[model samples]
Target: MEMSLQSMQLQLQFFMHKADDLHSCLVNGQGHVERDALAAAVVSFLYTCQPYFNHLESTVRSTRPQHTSLALNIYTQLLDIYQQLCDKLEQLVLSCASYNLLCLEETEPNSVSHFCVGQCQLGQLKLTTFLYCKPTPYLSQVDTRLYKRMRWNVEKLQVGQKTDKDQGGESKEREAKTEYYFLCYEDIPNTHAETDWGRPGFSDGNVVRMWSIGQWVQVDPDPITETIDDWILCDVPQANYNKLLFLGIEEPSCCIATDYMQQLLLLWKSADSW
Candidate 1:
């Protein structure tokens, strides 16, 4: 069924009114703007209004109207609305990501990055990925520290394990089953092990000193020294204990949001190698 130009104009006007209401609601509460809600509204508007734009374009192209200038004016208005919708979407996405990052600072205060020089390896493994650390019972009542955990996804180096198979009463070699490692972070304060704290940001003479706080680990499925030695150390500072913690990410916008996520308004993209 072919809809008339007048009908299309009415639909466009209705949506334009809705867009105005949305804009007014968004701007009224400047301090307490609901970013996620705004983002959702922008997305919904884009979805709903896309068909109208298509219909308008088709009507303008297919129908050789008597008054071409009036049709062109309506098309221009539709294009302007479409551009505004796109701009709103961009603003909403950025606002939501930034707001989420700010929330993390208060909610997870101990995880923020303190110092950086180029890229830190310790920061790379833990920053943006989800973690699950097994909390151990307090070793002593005097020690009130909580467990800081890191989740590692480590793949087996070889395709399969080496095994012997019987072939015509003669032993033949076969690949063994592939193994995987599930690792977590262990907050060991003495990871420095008598080594000099040579990080060049803050002075040791100050009240706060930089340190190697702990290391990443998984329980040895088989006690192999080589596997144990490959664990990455958690190098951080005593001062950043109360700030938001981030690990493994190279360029984070804030504590919990990474550069990639900041670019796309998604969740923080992990920078972990292993």
Candidate 2:
């Protein structure tokens, strides 16, 4: 069966409608809209993946000799997109937890710092993140810069983990000045946000750290002249929910469809070599 882009778009829209209907009228939950939104996002991902999936199926069904390289490229890109789609979906879910969460009207310095006041806990989304610092300033000491960069690295990740680089590669010959970003801790979801967990990566109700590349995350209990917790960029010159994200820097959040899905994709790639 041939599935063209237009056909897939229709398919995606249909699924979204079906999901939205189920979400609004059929399903019952406090976060059903968020759930429905995620369902639609999953459909969106399939829409993007459909083209490559169709090509893969066609190659299998056709009698003509298949171009192995062409198939591999499409497959690799499909997997990458699938991964990216999951990451976006997770961010949506995490953020949606804050939806209808009583927008903070006070927008005052003292009010924003209190989670219960201007912020709320997201226990289910299970995000592990670091506090990112402001953009490179007039500049500073090496250790400070390195630590800042480590947090930055954690924030830059969208999806994927650090796998050891090829040993034979020239990785060991790196310049002396570079600061190594380390993975501080792996976060475990408590399922309950009633209390603030301590140590490793938990503090002030939320402080989970996972890094990739050189990106900075602000430290917990922000080290500033004054103590405040809301995104500073959001507070300065006044902030609304819409402007907070844009004003503050964004970092990557890694979430895969599932560990098994990752393994399946790898297996599919290995199968292609034969």
Candidate 3:
């Protein structure tokens, strides 16, 4: 039996949401309550998705030329979602294993916890707190020489809105639309041809810069006079958004920006050059 593209997309969406929920549970430290059930759901979801992947691949290969592009696009989206699901599954499994190990250690008092002072101590997992810095003033007018070979651009758009639910009922209002500045850039490698240099294009092997909404804080307690002020770019988690809405991201969850921000913070905290 053949399934419609819409049906396949919907199915993928369902699976993506399931994976997201399971991942959230693990991250929130609630895995202990339903570790077995969560693991079982992940396994069942993987098995169910296998056939859809095969079918999508076959459809992309066998579809008519007129419909091939759409079919291929859907296939690509499904593949991306599947990859995220696999990543979530890996994390879930690791979390479960860690939980089991902790339980074992608790049950057996003879087991000695291996670690040194101030190194590798067991404690509650705490979520990192991020502060919103003020946006950069006249960002476009600023010189890009400090960024080296990289290029920058800013976009102001209404990514989403705020809704207020009153005591009477839900009051829908479009008057209060929050506009955000979406900062994006591409880091071009100097190894490229001189002719291709300064040209704005996203090609293979080029590192896509992070997207940021805000800029640097005006009053810096520890000001660095050496470095030029730049716009701050962050991801969904740092921005305090549930998901990536600005980029029209269809995925249920994204960690690229969050991961990038975390690494940048670590470098800034550890490096003295900043």
- If scored against the real structure, what TM-score would every candidate get? 0.26, 0.22, 0.28
Whole-model lDDT for model 3 versus the true structure? 0.37
Report the lDDT tens digits of candidate 3 across residue range 1-274.
1356667667767866776776676556454557666655545654565565555534433342345776566655544543454454445445544655222121245321111000010111111211111122223234331111111121212234445555544543333222222223224343443335566554556543333323333322223442333323211111211212232212112233323333443454467322
Higher-scoring candidate on TM-score, 2 or 3: 3
Taking the tens digit of each residue's C-alpha lDDT, what string does model 2 give over 157-205?
1233344567533322222211112212223343344443433443455
Runs with alpha carbons beyond 4 Å of true place in candidate 2: 1-67, 100-274
Q: How accurate locally is residue 143 in candidate 1, as Cα lDDT from 0 to 100?
A: 41
Instruction: Write the residue-wise lDDT of candidate 1 on 56-124 in tens digits.
Output: 434433333346777666655544443343334334433433544222121244322111101111211
Best by lDDT: 3
**Total backbone clashes of candidate 1, pairs 3 or more residues apart or in separate chains:** 16
Superposition error at 197 for model 3 (Å): 36
User: In model 3, which runs have C-alpha deviations exceeding 4 angstroms?
Assistant: 1-3, 29-33, 64-274
Best by TM-score: 3
Off by over 4 Å in 1: 1-3, 30-33, 65-274
Task: Name the better of 1 and 2 by TM-score.
Answer: 1
